[model samples]
Target: MYRPKTTLEQWRILQAVVDHGGYAHAAEKLNKSQSSLNHAVAKLQSQLGVQLLEVRGRKAYLTEAGEVMLRRSRHLTQNVQDLESLAANIQQHWEPEITLAVDLAFPRSLLYPSLQQFLPECRGSRLKIIDTVITGTEEAITQGWADLVISHHVPKGHLGEVIAQVNFLLVCHPEHPLSQTSGPIDPNELSQHLQLVIADTSQSPDEKQGWLKSEARWTVSQFHTAVDLLLQGIGFCWLPEHVVQPHLADGLLKQLDLDGSSFRRLVSYLVKPRPDNIGPGSQLLYDLILSNRQVIRQDDNTATTGNNP
Candidate 1:
């Protein structure tokens, strides 16, 4: 294996000398002798066969080569610092990465804000968000694929906290046959038309959710696809109010006037797949979701009522 001639310490010393303006100031800041700082930088330049710094008057400045190398070296030093921080975090029981499985029905309004809050406080930890539908969320929990899960269903053996309730509204394109129907739409009428459904993203897909009373159904893997199909006036399906809010507001989509309830409220839970071994990062995210649960509920109510609360 080929070895590097210079060390990270040497590069760091060079950066300090340039950042602090000269050897004397850098030594004072780093609590090292000026001669030692000069020696380290000199040794680095000698090993690389490059004159990295030019001394004039009482200050040191970078040469053309030194300017390019210093820019690259700053990145290298920052990476090393991050690596050390990651190692320290690992030692303190902070997870290096956390996998979060969220149900398709969950509100993006709530999920995104929680993630935004968690980003800065994660302490170098990485987040993996898995967008799951129906049985897919349950699979993520039971199969040990996720550290945190937000789903409509909490599997048999695991415990979950009710985090948010999403309103799934039955909707169709404004120009569709359903939109022209007068008064309360009959269930029999719904079964005659095609329904666009989101397919279960699991190994073993389960029965489709909502008014599957229709014999003619089109299934897709994602909500966006379903929304696209709905926009074409092709079919009708129950979609989360948040996902369809903009379309509804724009008159691109309209909620169907069903005889009974026009919307279904799905209560999503925050579950820990490995509760006993929950890391600080996962727990922090969990707490954030819980703290923001009320805000999610308020948003849901606002969406349903068409008035700000």
Candidate 2:
């Protein structure tokens, strides 16, 4: 005859009883009379048709069935509290969702601090992240898909503020033929061999960058794909220093000694302009990004310049 009309208050009383280790102690903690606490537990057991308690040596203890129900009651109480918090957050005018587009080359490790800082202030908001390559980051905003973008290339006329500089190194597998070459490898020498390039993420086939030659090249949409193929001794190409440091240390990859200054690219942060409207949560996240950059700058070169953590 188990037909429990269990209220949240009953669950609270159960938890208090277990936490205080006896009915009388639990009643004292909850500021309720021991008789009222006992009545509530008895009523709960009767409604559920389960023996929830037993007294031995002047101490009230939970029965085997009570232990099982008590465990479930904890989760039910937590869920109820979470729902109430969510409702309060909603009432604060928090944005329901935000979309962030980041460049494939952009270091993902740098993003964590900003997100961690934003969580407490924007608990009610949901975030969607899109990883794009080169012009793809720009397209995400132009196509109305992203609310924010962090990339090296932004569309012309859109304002972007520089955040960090990423160093790109020309590298190849240690076993590759280029590693055997004697002198500083020049562009002409590089053109003769296969070049692994990250394909432009744009849908238009006509849009391409860094494609050295048509005769021998491998085009991929993701940088990791290019890295994987490069590791296989298929081709040689320039990749971010942060991304390839581990492979270099393991002697699986080596930098090609070229006669030139070190290659570096500047990356930027761009916020989608909505002159008329911007939600509080989205604004808080954007401000956090700026603050993260400042903190990283003050921190050290090694911390800001690394692969995804």
Best by lDDT: 1
Which residue pairs collide in model 2, if any? Answer: none
Candidate 1: tens digits of C-alpha lDDT, residues 1-309: 999999999998999999989999999999999999989999999999999999999999999999999999999999989999999999999999999988988877777777889989999898888899998888999987899999898889999887667789899999999999999999999999999898888989778556788999989988889899999888999998889999999999999879987788888788999989899999999988776663234544532311112
Tens-digit per-residue lDDT, 154-193, candidate 2: 6665666565667788889989988998878776777789
Number of residue pairs clashing in candidate 1, backbone atoms closer than 3 angstroms, sequence gap of 3 or more or interchain: 0
Model 2 spans > 4 angstroms off? 1-4, 23-35, 119-124, 182-184, 204-208, 211-214, 257-262, 270-276, 294-309
List runs of model 1 lying over 4 Å from the truth. 295-309
Q: After superposition, how far is residue 109 of candidate 1 from its true place, in Å?
A: 2.1
